[model samples]
Target: MGKRIRVGMADLNICSAPDSIITLGLGSCVGIILYDRVSKKCGMLHAMLPDSTKIRNNGLRAKFVDTGLEDLLAMLEKEGVRRSSLVAKVAGGATMFNFSSSSEISGIGDRNVDAARECLKKYNISIIAEDTGKDYGRTVEFYPETGKFEIRAVGRDVTFI
Candidate 1:
């Protein structure tokens, strides 16, 4: 095992073979992971919201799905990983709460998951595996060398996608 790189909420990072990236406390937030098997290059984004445009003056590129994905892709390209070789693994986006009304704000979790899928599709990247939408927070670890996306939630069995 190589060094484990930690990604904070609304942040992003990348790694290569023998290394891994991780993020914690995903509740109504989504973690989008992009990896290239050929190059063993991987990137993870902890997106807190679905869109950056929804919030004015949001300068954090990794805080939203749209801009976050764009930045991740660009970063991978700079590392010499081709977009065509990229595949994705997604986790988190738990509902986390029970809301009385069907308001837009109540569906942030769903929106975040949808935004990630749509953004990846726009980039022509296929999502190979996922663990999402339960009413629980998750912590994830992605091993670039093995393309293993490990998901862990309290009281649940660890899953590798």
Candidate 2:
């Protein structure tokens, strides 16, 4: 097994073949993986929110789906990977709390997933696979060598997307 580089909440990282990237405890937050299959270059982000524009104090580029996607793209580009060669995999976005009374605050997970889809569409990057939208939190790992995204959640079988 290669090194598993851990990405914390509201953060991002990159790796190459034989190495993998991971993020943990994703509830409403989302984790995105952008990779070039041929080159085995990969980038991962753990975004805490759907959009940074709505947050006044959003300073972290990796804290929102919109900005996080851009950050990953830029990182990949700097590593000599062509924008056209990138493909995406997304996970997380679980509605972890019951907000029946506060509808406005509910479905943050769904919103995060939607934002990820929209941002990827704008960038012309295809999301090849996803494991999103359930009540449980998740830990995700992306293997650049095989382009496999592994999803682990409590009381559930391991899944690959």
Candidate 3:
């Protein structure tokens, strides 16, 4: 049997099998899932911040969108997953907090979504599906073998990412 990998907040992981990656509690955060259909390899990242340019420390690298996506892609490449075979799926980036004024905290979710989209485009990876931008949190599951994703959000329907 293949192993099951769980990715926590501000964390990233890559696997070579279906049902190998899962992440939860994405509130104003993003979960990026990359799957290779031919090889059945998968990778998942949970990023809390839109970019890492402001952070000088490496401790929070996984929390940033740019660095997190790069790391996840490199890890998958090391596992013999080719870039051309990778199909992307994303979830989360929900606006969990309500604010009366425009501020960084209030727009974090939107920024995260935009950053993710730009990064994926830069990598030339097409996003096959996504469940993003609401007012709740979400949990995501990826099955690489079939390139299927299951996304569950609070007070909303469970969607196939």
- The TM-score leader among the candidates is 1
Q: Output the number of the lDDT-best candidate.
A: 1
Give the runs in model 1 whose Cα sits over 4 Å from its true position: none
lDDT of 3: 0.85
- Compose the digit string of candidate 3's lDDT tens values, residues 1-161: 56678999999988776356888778899998888888888888899888898767756778998999999889989988899888888888888888989887989998998899999999999998988897888888887766778887668787775
Error of 1 at 27 (Å): 1.1
Better of 2 and 3 by lDDT: 2
1 against 2, candidate with superior lDDT = 1
Model 1 C-alpha lDDT per residue in residues 19-128, reported as the tens digit of each score: 89999878899999999999899999999999888899799989999999999999999999999999999998888777899787679999999999999999999999
- Local distance difference test, each candidate: 0.92, 0.91, 0.85
Candidate 2 residues 74-149, lDDT tens each?
9899999999999999999998888767575677889999999999999999999999998999999999999999
N/CA/C clash count, model 2: 0
- Deviation from truth (RMSD, Å), model 3: 1.6
TM-score of 1: 0.97
**Each model's TM-score?**
0.97, 0.96, 0.92
Model 2 residue runs over 4 Å out of place are: none
Instruction: Report per-prediction Cα RMSD to one decimal.
Output: 0.9, 1.1, 1.6
